[model samples]
Target: MAWVVAGVVCVLYFAGTARPGYLLVRDFVTVPDPVLGAAALGRDGAAPRAVPLDAITAVLDPVVPAALQQRLLLVGSVLLLGAGVGMLVRSRGWPAVVTATVVATWNPYVVERLLLGQAPTLLGVAALPWLVIACRPGPYRSQLARALLAALPAALTPFGSVLAVATLALVTTATSGARRAAAVALPSLILCVPWVVPALAGAPTRSAAQGADAFAARQDSGLGLVGSVLTWGGIWAPGAHLSSRAEVVPMLAALALVLVVAASAILAVRGGGRRAAALVLAWSVPPVLVLALATPVGLSVMEVLQQVPGLALFRDTHRLLGVSVVGGAVLAGLLVARTTRSLSPPAVTAAVALIVSVVVTTVPDGPRRLHAAYTPVAFPSEWADAVSSVPAESRHVLVLPWQAIRPPLPGGRVPFLDPVPRALEPPTVTSRDLVVRRADGPVLVPEGEPEIRLDDPTQARRALDSRQIDVVWWWGVPESEPPPGFVTVHDGSQITVWRRGGDPRSQLPRGILRPSTD
Candidate 1:
């Protein structure tokens, strides 16, 4: 059953595969930056993000044939998910387990989420069933497998780890022994050390612990919130999606599935007072809280909650929808098993297969369009040459465009992609700052991330000196030449590089920091 669903999902994923071109949209950028490594380890920023996926990406590096990278991840993830769901319903026999597998793998929302590049969160989703298994009364061998299963998602993100832990707590497990809890938790901690230690250090991303705007549901109303969960719209991040087009059929499908899940869980809980059924319903709390935050009262409550560290890790509330989907599938499986028990084996098989086919086929072809967005770009030789020319000790070059700021974007201020920050090597500081234009003028405010505004030569140089910037790499041809004492090293069609006093590491008098009023 798992194999059948896994094969179908893999085919669906690869259907969109294209080389050198697969890298399209913000989600697909393959920039080379090492600061993320530092950030992941909790060394630099006050609010550093968890980057388990980034670590895997770094390991895959230039060796893994850049074009195939996302494909590999996409395929591996869906297969693991299919298998995990299959194992969860394995005791249910043919029709029930098969139906659950289809429900889990027939993930239309997952396509949109993947397009938005929620890879780390998706890994948590895939790890869910295994996390549930770890909570069940089981032998040491099965418990060991549970530990390993718990580790994958735990290593991915804080959100995933919390879900894993919460599930162990919420579900009415027969096993009360601390041994089972210990088995699940111990490996999770060991596996997630790279992220856990840094996050524990009390660093926060600039936007960390911020607000409901970043954390709440994209859709405000209860129905809209429910629909968003059905269609996987919670992340509210930038990505091309069919739901954005108001496609009626998909919207209706989402609403229907939500009903099916709700009804199934209700029936299961009422019928036998099942712990698993209750657990799935409990999973809805996070998304529900996000929806509640749409109101002024809820926003006030969330602000108070923000005082606790790691609480906002799930700010992009859509990440938690994976658990809800899993719960729906589990309950749906139970309903199928009970209602169809009277049918002959062959008849049940045909009926369930037909149902699975209809559900999968009707799903919007969002991933296919996403696959069309694939566009792989080779790293420019000019940037490579510039990096090589710098003195060995030189660290964190500041680019000419000081930071990525924008005119207007739906999610927030994102710089135009001409010279994205990720293109530079580690120790390089580019900007991820939020910028806004005041009604009165052309000035841009530094809203979130730390940024240095160097709109002119002297100010730019002073900003450089204050921070002890090593190299200044500019891609655009500014009307004015660089400041005095700066020696031009390489001026080519792609970029112009300058070394101050023949060294990117040169020092000048200590100066005031770049004024915010600039």
Candidate 2:
């Protein structure tokens, strides 16, 4: 029966895989800076500042489409979820409860993230509960196989690696004589050794520096740290005020339920059980404390701490959703065991209600569309296609400001320069400008902030000459006036491409025009 339920869930996930492109367009469109950075690293050893836009373009690159990979990821997540359910059904007591908790924690919201190619954090969160279940001192003799199974997911991604280590350390400390925990943790340690090679081979990239800065920035504000926790925990709704009376009711009810179950569990299992409870508290404490110290008062303590340096290593605080659910499951299971022993029908009914309530509250709404705040930036299909239409031999194509390219070009070999806010570099640019002055390639002049400064023809010409830029893609033009010395070749509702001078190709190098088909 348990396997049947797991099978149904897996099928639902698999059935949803057919429209990976549409899914990417709808829900996973927001090209985060980190994802952009990762893509750039995958393309070229160094990432680019102007690569965020280019990365999106690269994902759509005709040569290397991400559709198949996305589908496989969806399939894998479904299988993982089924595996989690199977583990729960086969286990007993706290271990069974832990497995169930992991299933609940791998919620639709988290699954949605996974479906969208953001596997690092999801992988990390998934590893923790799995490790706990695998390392629990039990009668299982397949120690080697269990250890490998526990470590494999964690070792696959950066986020998972951190979470695997943290869980291993915490579980070992909490579980007396759980010496085999070290064996389970060995795989992750072994897997992470290679990242060091990259650090050794080149000068440190801004990733480390930026990561540090991002962490420190959170520490300094404390608001983000707090808000991050609340948001991550799924406790704070997008538009609702935390202090409102409406919010207080749900918060209080959830808290009351959690406390009641926890107390009941402790009372049912005195002695060793009490010790186990203490260990649970201890295991849960550090993350909470780190969150509290990192976040300010009035913030959702759990969410904010997720952004801290050490904590930030684990991207999703909602992963703790597994912890909460697992804790509740353990409490419920213990309560059931105790109540059944006493043969109290009324108590049993109440316990069933409590279990149902926990499940109801925790099952987050299934994956939804990307937030409005991120929609425009998320869907870049039209823009990517437009950019790809540029003739390959054309060296200098000016990209207009409004048409922001996303997912920088694959391999970071192609150069894309946007002229936006001078203070801000494009999210995907390498330390050096490889394409800016290339004799054979066309320089891309991104329209907008910096180009707005080009309102003065002399200044614009000087700006153009300085960067060796020849062509301009102008967007959002009025009929009355347009920039001087440029002939409009293409004009649309919000964009216009311009060729500067009759001999626009004079400065462009031969064979430089290779339109990006991604």
- Clashes within 3 Å, all models in order: 12, 41
- In order of appearance, the predictions have TM-scores of 0.78, 0.53
- lDDT tens per residue, model 2, 409-513: 322211122321111122211122111111233333221122113333354446455544444544344343334545556555544555555542222212212
- Score candidate 2 by TM-score against the native: 0.53
Best by lDDT: 1
**Stretches of candidate 1 above 4 Å error?**
18-42, 59-69, 139-145, 168-174, 200-211, 220-223, 238-240, 304-312, 344-350, 381-383, 390-392, 400-426, 434-461, 475-480, 484-498, 502-518
Worst 10 residues of 2 by lDDT: 428-437
- What digit string (tens of lDDT, one per residue) describes model 1 on residues 384-493? 66655555455555655544431212222212322233334333444543232222333332323333434445755666566456566766444446545566677766
Stretches of candidate 2 exceeding 4 Å from the true structure: 1-20, 25-65, 71-89, 93-103, 106-120, 133-146, 169-184, 193-249, 264-269, 273-279, 296-334, 337-354, 362-518
Error of 1 at 79 (Å): 2.1
lDDT for 422 in candidate 2 is 16
Error of 2 at 252 (Å): 4.8
Q: Write down the lDDT that model 1 would get.
A: 0.55
